[model samples]
Target chain A: MLNEFFENAPCGYFSFFDDGKIFVFNETFCKLLGYDKEALKDRNVESIFTLSTRIFYQTHFFPLVKMQGHAEEIFLSLLTNKGQHLPVLLNAKREEHGGKLFTSCAFITVPNRKKFEDELVAAKNVAEKALQENSELLKAKADLQQHTERLDAQIQLVNKQNSELKQLNHVVTHSLKEPLRKILIYSERINDKAQPNILKLARATKQMRVVVTGLQQYVWLDNTPSHFTHIDLNDLAEKAAAQLRQELNADLLNLHMVKLPSLEADAEQIQLLLYHILSNAIKFKKDEKAEVTITATALKQNIFRSVEHKYKYEDFIKLEITDKGIGFDPAFKEYIFDLFRKLHDTEGHGLGLALSKKVATNHFGLIEADSRINEYTRITVLLPLFQTTR
Target chain B: MQKNILVRNNVKVFGNGTQPMLFAHGFGCDQNMWRYITPAFEEDYRIVLFDYVGAGKSDRTSYNAERYSSLHGYAQDVLDVCEALELQDTIFVGHSVSSMVGLLAAVEKPEYFSNLIMVGPSPCYINDADYIGGFERKDIEELLETMERNYIGWANFLAPNIMGNADRPELGQELTESFCSTDPVIASQFAKATFFSDNRKDLFKLKVPSLILQCSEDIIAPVEVGNYLQENLSNSTFKLMKAKGHCPHMSEPEETIMYIKEYLG
Candidate 1:
């Protein structure tokens, strides 16, 4: 009765020698493997295992059993005679019987259990992937928060600086202006050998007043709020050129202006931008004839202002103003954009190009200068065709 | 300084002889795997065993993901253990992936090692156009899945026992201890590093004489791989063993020892 029970047991039973040669197995084990007793003779236990299971058996399961004498509840898949994988829950124990050592193993086929476990593992993997993605999103949000906070702090600092500059502008316009007027009037009244020196002093004071006024205009650009509207660049360029012609009283100021695309920008600021650039070309002329040409092209590209700031624009109008004049060294291309930077010590307070850059920046644009010594100097202004309300 | 390195890797030194024989374990296990093979060498050579940082009783806190991400990191562990013990002319015995690890160490510092004994070693596990590594990428993925299921089973088995000894935390330590206990995450990373790595290019850099002990039916390192290694590695002796599967040092230690002794003689 015990022999019949062993053969008819629900779980498959097998015994292998320490060298992995199978010596005995139950009928149920043979049926599960779809192999006859004769066919199973002289076969190793690993012969029935799939590739991955054989690896697991050799690397993990075999080692565990050898060290701990038994391994329970191990998951492994066995290959049957018909070449189908049969997932099984395996329990193994190393035993010494009749002065010889061998291993006894019981296998319970668990197809349903294996399927459920795989589903659970798949779900767990999905959850883990979701958690990883969520954490990455949270990190990105935190970085953006940090960036916004830094920008807010920078804006507050700029506001404070602008208010302080406003106070300085008030002092220069009111307090310094009255004293300079007194000096010029008193110098003109002097009638002696000192009269020539007095005239020189008055001329210096006049130049100081022009510099002070230019400083006021430069500071005002930051204080005033910009009002953007659709402005025709052709009209603005003509008006600027005509004004320069009237002011310089020189018909030799040749201006070849191209048809430019109308873009949404601050009309007043753009007008100032055009006037400053045209005036610089005329002021730094080689001789009496000041020849300037303006051309425009539309581009879809990115504007790189600095390493940290890059703005992508779908549509941008690039305006190039080239002047055949006595251009300064190309090294001072960026330096010429500073408020008090003058390369040739010419007439004017050296704030023209700086004011032009300020106006272009306020309109979300970039102005760059490319020049060569005693050749043509080209000033390129790239402005976005469309403006978003700030 | 030596004590810190020793503790970090759980370095154990024992022998009756003067020359050092450093044994490096492979993935999925620790230095305890050498127990079956180390006894034969204990009388004739100094036996040095160490758990690579994240495995066994070594310092788990020192497991840096970036450092242990490649075989080079494990190679550094071998070198560190060598430097700490001040071993010279060492006969290095490495099993499985540690074969490549030992190769890297010997290539980096050839002065410290004299011979490399590799058991069931494969330079690459994934097959390419010209080389057959005996596994597809899919098979490795399945292995990783199986590993995860087993680790989960272990965790589930330990959870209740851990909760029962919540008041006695010291008892919890013993309850959690198991043979070849490796951190599951580190094991997975180690698996990726081992199976996915291609150290074929590093074979030419080996200056030390070596022995390749290829098992009969090793799915991990097939006979073709052993032949490939013998052909590629200069001044190397290849021996095909009767023992089947990987880990011949454990399964057939007597034969493993005889080959080492013969080669050393």
Candidate 2:
């Protein structure tokens, strides 16, 4: 029976001398490290791990084994012969073989680290990108009073001219939207269309969008469009929450919403923007506590007339959504909106925030964030309110 | 079949006597932990020794997650062997983690074991109102953090290691390198369970006649914890091993085995 087990045992088992030389390497360890019986017998423990980590093992880990004579279930990385790391915990005994001491041990490996790291990075990149996009929008808003002044001077004093300018601005902004969307689509499509340059083109398309937003008057809010529609902020809140709950697994989340007042504006884009922010907050949770709140209220419609976004913005409305959960590195705040940028090695980048940013700005709105790591993150969306507020 | 069951861990049954005695190893060590103590019992007893799933020579693949996350999983493994062997009126001997495991096994299946000889058993790792196990939550947390940072093969990362931990100097780094180890996740969970688990209830429910060995300066299982087990376990005799550190069986094996023989008599 012992012979059968020695050949086909489930867990890793082996032994090493106090000097960190291998006296035994079991079938499991051999399989995990992809080493042969001959290879293992002659290998010193130090030669098995990589240089940076081998030194660690020599200084910290192996010494403990000698002193303690044994250890149980310690999670650490082990390097295989082919140079791949195996995460394992070891339990050993101080064996007296003749006059010298040795460690007789066994262990098991977890294969979840890489997967977890990927998920963390992807998710982080997406969140960071979203926040970065919001920052760009805020920066645009700050440049607003100045741009509005310059543009106002260009087409001031003539009502007919102002109306004509509005039509041109509409055409320019609306056309920019499809092409921008097409850029993102084509870039992602390039992954399959031109696989070699997928990463390069992907990066290009994202950078191109930033330049477009920065170079041109990103948004041209009409002063008082006849087509302005009444948007029920409460309805938008409910819609966003319903969709977010479904996306993030409602059973795992604590979502709360306050009755919000209505404000009329670009309903389609406003709805789309809210949905993205809320969904994002929901996606970032992993066994940690998650909570989200979305609330909106009418802003006094007069701020629009005073605001003058390059001579547009006939209204003002504010919507707030707050999430308390794992946050990101502040150092990457600028890179958050960059496509393919990852923070925690999880998944996805740039799309959520870029799309949300586009929807908000194209609809004559602003979005910004105030965040601290492992703490609360608040996103504020400022949009133009329609005259008939509910 | 029962011999085969433990054979995967290289646990050989030595000696040729009718009265069977099982020796359980402690944490940080394996069934080989009973090497010195078993020699004394061999002449008079049918000696049994086997490694726990996480210990020496055991089948690493056989270590089931849902199964071996707690000490009771080990207890069940002991019972499995006892049932397989059809051993009765057996004297159960356990060291460190296995001591508590043997106690739990005896409580659950008393028919096989007549007396449990617990060498350095700790019911809990925390200092409760009455018990002082010489470990604090922070201390355990630091130990766990140490494993996460150092002991586990955290740095030999495949590629693009996490900037924070994959680089920083970890606590208990020295302890981590001694041997081939288990996965970090399992190690963390095990540490939490071992250090934080409160088995005061298990002690209260123990029924078998037992001998509780307490080492004078055992870092892992303190003297008070042994006394606590003795106080709770009726018909249990308590003796202080004149030694220190976690494994008295390794440090002072001669005296440790001598005390066991006297307890048996």
Candidate 3:
């Protein structure tokens, strides 16, 4: 009965000598490897394992067992003659026989446990990937937000500088101009017919006054806090046209108005912007009759490439004032908005378009001009619909 | 910084002599493996014993996966111990995998060491077409699986049995408790790093005098491996012992000590 119990154990059992020559093995152990007991004689225990497992046995398993005297719950795959793999958990203990050390190993196959472990490894990999993505997204958002805040501080600094420049312009206007006024009045009072050069000097002084007034307007852009209220662009366009009627020939200057959207913006600044653009259209007209078209629409896409960094918002109110004028080269488009930049003969001081750009920037908007030489010039002003704290 | 390495490797200095002798233990057990051997040399040589990080009583917190992934990392630890103590012309007695570790340390900085004693060393554990390393790749995987499954209960099962001397039961129990004290994860990593590493090409670079103590019968480091080491090493003496297992230092310390003394002469 004891012999039967030894042969018919639930798990496979084997005892190998120090040299790895198998001395004894149970019938169940032989069955597990699909080999008979007599056929397994003098066989190295490493022969039953796969190539990797055999290496494991020599380097890790054998060394640990030799030094520790026992190794428990080791997983190994037993390879059969037919190339079938049986995954098994082995618990081994070193036993002494006649003053020599031998190892007794018990093998128990666990197929479902292997599957469960694989699932656990897979779930861990997925969780790690998700955590990595979440951190990356958070980092990107924080970077963008940090950049935006820096830009806000820079805008405030530029506004402060503009106010300081306006203060200087006010001083120049009050202190120096009073002396020039006396020179103009005294020269006009002389009215000497023989001295024609005296009259020319008087005319030059008057021109200087006009230039100084234009400089004052340019400097005062950031002086007043913007009063944001709902105002119709169509009304501003009509008012601009009426103001420029003195310079424009009504019959030849054909003004077309498209249905314009109302926006929350500085009414005074919007009126000034419209006036500057309309006056420019009349000033640089090529044909006998100037046809100026003013149109306004809600910007659905982000087309402002240059100004994209300034604002994180995408929605804007775009107002385009297209003109039948002698336009400059398209390559010179970027320089047109620069201060004192004159593409054509100067009728007004070159500050008109520069001041227009300043107005758009101060309102958290952008103005760009696209043109073809001797063709049409389209000036686009993009303004956010909602008010922004300047 | 030297103190950190001392704490990290759990370096212990013993004996009273001018000549320094350093002993590095193998994978599973700690510095206690050299207890029997170091005592014999204590009167003549200054003995130094240390546990590799993550093994024995070394600091587990300092085990960096990248740093300790290869044999080079353990070699650095050996060098650190030498540097901390400011020892020169030291005799290094490395057992099992540590033999190769000492070889690597000597290779990096040879001026510190005077002689090398390698006991049961294998340069590479995996067999190739031309070379027989006595192991295939799959055996290593099975061993890893065994380590994982046995990791939790390893202390309870093997510690007592491993301290196998029957004469002193308390010594066995103490060794068992100390063996069981290692962190499971670190032990597994140390096992992987030691076993999977290959340093066959580095053997030719050694310029120091060396001794290869080949045991009579060792399944782990077979006779063929010993023969290969004897053939490859440049400045070395090969001695075959009648001792039977991989660890003669523990099993037969007197014989191990006698051979070490002869080699020193």
Segments of candidate 3 deviating more than 4 angstroms: A49-51, A58-69, A79-85, A97-101, A121-390, B15-18, B27-29, B35-44, B125-174, B178-201, B214-228, B240-262
Q: What are the per-residue Cα lDDT tens digits for candidate 2 across B69-174?
A: 6666667678877877777988998876677778777865576988998877888877777568766676666555445554323434212222222222342343
Quantify how close model 1 is to the true structure by its C-alpha RMSD in Å: 18.3
Q: Write the per-residue lDDT of candidate 1 for residues B110-186, one digit (tens) a residue.
A: 77999999999999999999899999999899888778777765553333233333323443344235456777778
How do these models rank on TM-score, best leading? 1, 3, 2
TM-score of chain A of each: 0.63, 0.38, 0.59
Please state the CAPRI-style docking class of candidate 2: incorrect
Model 2 CA deviation exceeding 4 Å by range: A1-390, B1-4, B7-11, B152-183
In terms of lDDT, the poorest run of 10 residues in model 2 chain B is B158-167
Q: What's the interface RMS deviation of candidate 2?
A: 19.9
Top lDDT hit = 1
> Which window of 10 residues has the lowest lDDT sum in candidate 2 chain A?
A305-314
Query: A119 in model 1: Cα distance from truth in Å?
Result: 2.6
lDDT of model 3, residue A305: 49
TM-score of chain A of 1: 0.63
What TM-scores do the predictions have? 0.59, 0.39, 0.52
Question: By descending DockQ, how would the candidates be arranged?
Answer: 1, 3, 2
The Cα error of candidate 3 at residue A170, in Å, is 50
Point out the higher-scoring one by DockQ: 1 or 2: 1
